[model samples]
Target: MSAHEDVGELVPEGTFLRPDDSVRRFAGGTVLVGGSPLWLLKLGAQGARVFGRWVNGGEALRRNAGEQRLARRLLDAGLLHPESPRGRFTLADLTLVTPVKDNASGVHRLLEATDELSERIIVDDGSVEPLPEAALRHEKPLGPAAARNAGWQRVRTELIAFVDSDVVPETGWLDAILPLFSDPEVAAVAPRIRSRPGDAPLERYEQDRSALDLGSRPAPVRPMSRVSYVPGAALVVRRSALAELGGFDTRLRFGEDVDLVWRLAASGHTVRYAPESVVWHDPRAGLLEWMRQRFEYGTSAASLSARHPGLLCCAKVSRWSALSWGLLASGRPVTALATAAVTTALFPRALRGRGIPATEALRLAGVGHLGAGRILAEATRRTWWPPALVAALFGGRARAVTSAVLLPCLIESAGKGPSWALLRLLDDLSYGAGVWAGCLKERTIGPLRPQFTDDSLCRGSGRRLPASRSIGSKAGRTCDRSRSSQRYERVGAR
Candidate 1:
C-alpha cells in the first residue's frame, strides 16, 4: 500500500474537487499540476481520463486496483487528497456567533441567512437602542475582538462560527467549509465575502471588487502569500483551538480577523480561505465611509508591525524588486535601472541561498523589477510625479514606459472599467495613507521599514528546524507552529 493507501477511509464528501488554477495541458500528451506543490505527468489518454475521473468525484472507482494505484500517483503529485469521512462533523457540530453594534436590519438579515445549527449566539456590543429578541446583550460596547470572545465563551460546542451581522451566508456554505477541519491541526476556515451590489458607482465598484473579498483561491492563510488574512466576517473555528490560544485579542478594534489568523499560522495551526463557501456583505458604498474604513485599517499596521517586528515585510520578494518599485513610483527611470543593475551586480550577496546561478537570478530579478516599476509609477501618479518626468519629456523612454503601462491596462481590464492597474494604485494609496497616519500617530517608521527573511534562519539549537516552524517563525527563530502564543503575546497581527 502507498502512503495515501487507507482501506477504511471514505472519499472527502465536502469541497474536494481539484482546483483548476494551475493545471496545464500541452500539445503533447503531458500535463502539469503546477502551483505551490508542483508535479509533472506524461499522461496517455487513459491516464488523463483517470485524473479527470478523480477530480470529478469518482470515489466508487477506488475499489479497482488500477484506479487505486492511479489515485496514489495523483495524491503523491500534490494534485489531490483522499476525502476524509464527512461523518466526523456536521452543521450541528459548530455554534453560530454574530456580533452587532446597532444594525437591527443587519442582524435580521444575518439570522435569516444562516442555516441549521444547534446553537446561535449574538453579542450585542453596546447597542444604544433596545436589543432584538434574538440577541445576547452586553451593556458595554466591547470591540469586535472582545465581542467575538464573549460569544464564543457561552457555547460549549466543538466549533464556534463568528459571522459579522452585515454578512448573509449563502446556501451550502457550511457543508462546503466544515470539512476543512477534518485535519485536526486546522484551527479555522473563513468563507469569501462577496459584496452586495449597490445603486451608486462606489457601491458598484465594491460589488465588482471589494477590499474584503479575497477572490476564489484556496490558500493557506500565512504572512506574505496571496491569501494572507481570513476576514472575521465569516469564520468557522475549532473551539478547543481558540480556547487554548485565549480566543480573539480584546485589544484589537479592527483587523482582529487578520490578527487571529496570523497568530494561528505562527503557532503552527492551519487557517484556510474557502472561496466556495461564500457570504454576501453590505459594502461601504459612500466615499466617506470607504475612506474612514480604509484609514482605520491603515492605523492597525503600526500596531501589527510593533507586535510582529520581523513578520510584516515581504517574505519571498527580493530587495532589488522592492527598490525598483519605489524608484519607478518616484518617476526615476534611470535610478530604477541603476538599482536593478547594482542588485544584479552584487548577486553573490543579494541573492544567496536562492538556489539559482547569479546571472540567472539577476535576469529573473530584472524582469520582476520591470513589471513592478510600471505598477509603482501608476500608483504614484496620484501622489507625486518625480524627476523622471523631466526625462520622460525628452526621449523614447517616456513613450516606451507609457506603452508598457497602458498596454497592460487595456488587455487586463477587458472592459472591467478604469484598468485594474489604476484600481490597484488607488487601493494601495488608500492603505498607504492609513499606514502613514498610523506611523505618524505612533511616531515610528516601523510600517515603512523592511523586514527581510533569511532562507537560512534557525532556532537557538544547532539542529535544523522543521519547515513548519520556519515559515511560522517570528524573528526567524525556530518555534513550534502550534505552541502557545502566550509566551509571545505582543507578537500578534491584523
Candidate 2:
C-alpha cells in the first residue's frame, strides 16, 4: 500500500514543520519535528528547497517527481496532511448501549444528548435508588463489563453505540464516528471524552486533562497507537465482532473496555478514536472521590498489563520527554538543554522495524511510548515527582522545571491556577499507588515488566513483525535497524 493508504489527514499536534511558519535562516535549512531531528524529510538540498517553498506559500504539496517523492515521504512521516475521508454509514444500523449504576440524572442527560438513536439500551447494574422504569434493569450488579455484555446481546443492528450514563454526547457524534465501521476490520470506534462542567479546581483541571480524553487526533485504535483503548464510557462497535469474541470477558468489572479493545486488536481487528465525536463527561467534582476514581481506574491497568503485557512497561517510554523532566528535576539545568541531542539521536533508532520507514516508525513510537509512558510514569509517581517538584522549586530551577512539567497542562487547564496542575501530580501519584496495590493483590510483578521484540530471535525463526507494520516500502525493504531500533516491538503472545 502507498503511504496515503492508511494515513489519517488530521494531525492535531502540528508537525515540527508546516505550510506556514517563520523560517529561520542558517548555514543550511533545518526543521525539527516535535523537537527531534527532521524525520519528516531527509532535509537534503532538494527536499529543503521544496519544503521552503511550501512553508512560504502555505502549500501542502507540489506536483512533480522529486517534490511528489518528498511529499509522499512527508506524508509517511505524518508531516503532510492527507484529506480526511468523509464517512458514510446509516445511523439506523447502530445501537447505543450504556451501563449505569446510580446515575439517574446522568442517564437522563444522556437521553437528551443522544436523541438521535432509536435503540438505546441503559442496562441498570443495580442502582441504589433504583433507576427509572425506562431502563433495562438487571436485578443484580454484574459490573460494567458484564452489564455491557447483557445489553449488546439484545442488539440486532450491525453496530452498537455504548455511552456511559455520566457523559452527554454532543450533536453529530454519531454522524462523525459511526462511519468508521465501514472498514470491516474496525470492531469499534470511540469518541473524545471531554470533561463536563465542574465547580471546583480539580474538576476544572480534569477539563483540560481528563484521563479519558485522548487528545484531538484521529488514528487507528490499537494496543499502542494514538489510542490504545477507547474508554467504556462511549464507543460504536460492530455487533458480530463482539459476539465472536464472547462479548467482553464478563468477569472483568473494571477495565473491561480496555480488555475488549485490546482483545479486538489481538484477534486481528481494528478499533479507532475520533476526536470529532465529542462526549462531555462529568468528572468527580470533589477531591476524595476524584482521587478514588483515579485509583479505581489504575487497578484496571494492572489487570490490563497481565492481559496485554508489553504495553505497560517503562521500556515503552516512547519519547525523550521524561528525560528532560528528569534532568530539570535533578537541578541540572546545564544537562536538560542536551535533551534535544538525546532525542534527535533516538529519532532514527525507533525506525528499525522491517517494513515501517524511519519517520513513520518514529511517530508510532511517540504514540506507543505515550500510551506506555503514562503507565510507567504513574508507576514512578510513588518514588519520583514529589521530591523532584520540591528540589526544582527550592533548588532554584522553578522556572525551567515548571515549564517542563506543566507547559502542556496550561492548555488543558484552560487558565486554571497552579492548583489544577498540582492536582494533576497528585492524580498520577494516586494512580501509581493503585498500581502498587494491584500488584500486591495479584501477587506478581508482571504488572511492571517490559517486553520487546528481539529481532535476533526472529531472524533465525523467520518470523515477521505484527501485520500492522508488516507492509514494507520499496526503499525500506533493505532498511534494517533491529540492532538500533527500540520502538515498533512486535505484538502477540511471547
Candidate 3:
C-alpha cells in the first residue's frame, strides 16, 4: 500500500495537532526544521498558508483536500502530533481479553477496574486451580502469546483489548485512545503502563523507571524510533488488522508484543503509543523477581533480532561520530579534536542550499556528537557490559573509561542516592548477562552488532507527497496538474 494510504487518505477534520517542541520555522515559515532524525521541509506558498492556518487554530480543519494532506504529511514526519481526536468510541465496542496463569486476585482487580466492558474473556494457561471465569483453558502451560491468541480468536467485537491480568486501568483511560481508531490505518494503540504506588525502595525505583513504561510522549510506534514498542499489558487493537496478521507468534515466549508490533509496521499498518491513557501495573513481588523479569526481557533480544535483523542493533552512529569517539577512546585527544572540527566544517557544506547558518550547522554537529556518545554509553551498558566489566577489572585506564561510560546511569538515578546507583549497576549486569546467555543459546550475535551510517548528506525532489489540491509555489505558479507541489529537503541524520 502507498504511504498515504497506510496513514489514511486524509487526516480527519477536527483532529487537534501541535508542532513538536524541536520544530522551528524559518524563511517566513516556509521552511520547517524538525522531525525524528531531524530534517528541513520546504513548503510551497500554498502549503505554508495551510500549515499556518492549522498552527493558528491548533486544530486541523478540512478547508480543502490540500490542507488535510499537508496535515497528514507533517504528522507522518513527526513534526506535528495529534493532541486529541474529535471522534469517540465506547467500551461497548470493545471485548476485553486477559491472559492469566495463577493470578486470580489480579484477575479480580482487573475485572473490577473495567466493569463497563460487557465481553470479557479470560484465558487460563494451565493454572493449578482452574479459574471459573476462564472462557478458554489450556491443559498445559502455553506462553502468553499463545494464550492471547486463543482469547482474541474467540472475540467477536470490532475491537479486541489485550490487557494483562496484573493491570488495573485508570478511569477514562479509553478517552484518549478510542478516538485514535477513527484513523482506519491505526491497527493498535497502547496506554502508558505505570507501576502501582507503593513505599518500598524497589517499588519506588520501579515506579520511576518501569520496563513497561514508555514515558509521557505520544508517538507512532516503529522500530528504532523515540518510542519503539508498547507493552501488551494494555493494548486495544482493531479486530481485522490482528486477524490479517494471523495474531501473535506463539514461538516467542518473551517479547511477543515487540514482535507483533514490528510485524504490524512491516505489514504497513500503524501502531501507536498514547501516554495520555494510563494503566497501573503491579511491580514484581521482590528484588530477585524484578531482576529475573529484567533478565527475561533481555533474553528476548536474540529471538527478536532473528525475526527482524537490523532493528535489534545495539547502536547506530554516523561514520564521523564513530571515528571521533574511537579516537578519543584510544588516547588520541588531538586527533579526535581535529576529526570533530573536520566533521563540523563538512556539515554546512553538505547542507549548503538548505539556508541553515554555519553556526547552526556547527551546533547540530556538536549535538550529534554528544548524542552519539550517549548512544555508545547505553550500548556498552546494555550489550557490551560483559566485556566492559572484564576490561574494567584489569587496568586502571580501562576502569577509568568504564567509570566514565557508567556516569550516565549514575546521573539517571541521581536524586535516588548511592543505593539506587548500586541497584542500577546490578540491573545492567543482570540484563547484560541474560543477553549473553541468550546469544550463546541462539548462536547468533546479531543483537550485539552496531550499525554505522554515512555522514554525507543527500537531497532529492519528487512528487512523493500525497495527491490533493494543487499548492502554489514560491514563484506564485501552480504545480503541474499531474504532480504534487509539496517539496521537502532532508537535512540531517538518516
Candidate number of the best TM-score: 3
Runs in model 3 lying further than 4 Å from the true structure = 5-8, 458-486, 489-494
lDDT of 3 by residue, 1-494 (tens): 22752335666667777777778886677778777656677676566776776777664566455566666667766778775555656788899999999999999989999998899999999999999989999989999999999999999888999999999999989888888887766889999999998888888887887899989877788887777888998999999999999999999999999999999989877787888899999999888988998899889999999999888888888777888888887779899999877876766666555556767767777888888889988888878988888898988877877888999988898889876787787787778778888889899998888888655541122111223433334322333243333445544453
Residues 1-494, candidate 2: write the lDDT tens digits.
Answer: 12232442322121222431211332244332321112221243444555666666555443343454444434333343332244446878888888898888888888887787788888899887777733577777888888888888989898898888888888887766655554444578888999976767876778777889998866556564445678888888888998989988876667888888888877767566677778888888678898998888767767777888776553334234445545656687578657634453454453343333456544544553344444344444432344455666775665465455454445555566779767977787787667667777877666555444333222223232322221122221311233222112232111
For each candidate, C-alpha RMSD in Å?
10.0, 9.3, 3.5
TM-score of each: 0.68, 0.66, 0.92
Candidate 2 Cα RMSD after full superposition onto the native fold (Å): 9.3
Error of 1 at 45 (Å): 20
Best first by lDDT, ranked:
3, 1, 2
lDDT of 3: 0.79
* Highest lDDT against the true fold, candidate: 3
> How much is the lDDT of residue 201 in candidate 1?
59
Better of 1 and 3 by lDDT: 3
